[model samples]
Target: MLETIYTENAPKPIGPYAQAIKVGEFVYPAGQIGADPATGQLVEGSIKEQAKQALLNLSAVLEEAGSSLDQVVKTTCYLSTMENFQEFNEAFGEQFAGHEPARTCFAVQELPLKALCEIEVVAVVKK
Candidate 1:
């Protein structure tokens, strides 16, 4: 059976989609942007700042799904510009320090709410 995941710690979906979906032992979290859950506003500042918030949001959704960043087996990151790659990488490295998962990042033309960064993940539910 599939389970939908939701958490107040993360920004609510702006469209027709759940925060995440879990089936069997894996959970797939939708892309998380830099918007703050409390304000539903995109955070201001550098790409690193936005990347951090996006990761935090992704983490919250995973936690709500009985998973965690450490349990993530894969990640897909989107950046508005390649110029921010280094700074974004710095923030991402800080978050996944010891347990880096397989990842793919793309420099997209844009993202929802004009966020500088967005991240999504697939993780194994902790037993």
Candidate 2:
């Protein structure tokens, strides 16, 4: 069976999709931007700050799905500019330290809300 996941701590989905979906032991989160849930505003700052917020958003969705960042098995990162890759990695790496999940990072022409970075995660939820 599949279950939809949501949480007020994470920004509400802007389109027709749930924050995450759990099937069996795996939880897959949608790509998250740097939008602040309470303020409903994109986080403003350097790429590192934006990346941190995006990871935080992904973390909230994982928690809602009965998972945690430590359980994340894979991640896909999108960046608005390749030049910001180093700054983004500094923030993203700190979040997943010691838990090194498989990942792919790429530069994109744009992102929703004009976010500097976005991240999606796949994690395992204990059954």
**lDDT winner:** 1
- Whole-model lDDT values for every prediction: 0.93, 0.90
Could you say which candidate leads in TM-score?
A: 1
TM-score of each: 0.97, 0.96
Tens digit per residue, CA lDDT, model 2, 23-100: 999999999998898887898899888888888998988988889999999999999999998998889889887789
Worst 10 residues of 2 by lDDT: 89-98
lDDT of 2: 0.90
Across 40-69, the per-residue lDDT of candidate 1 in tens digits comes to 899999988898898899999999999899
RMSD of each: 0.7, 0.9
Query: What's the lDDT for candidate 1?
Result: 0.93
What is the Å distance of residue 56 in model 1 from its true position? 0.7
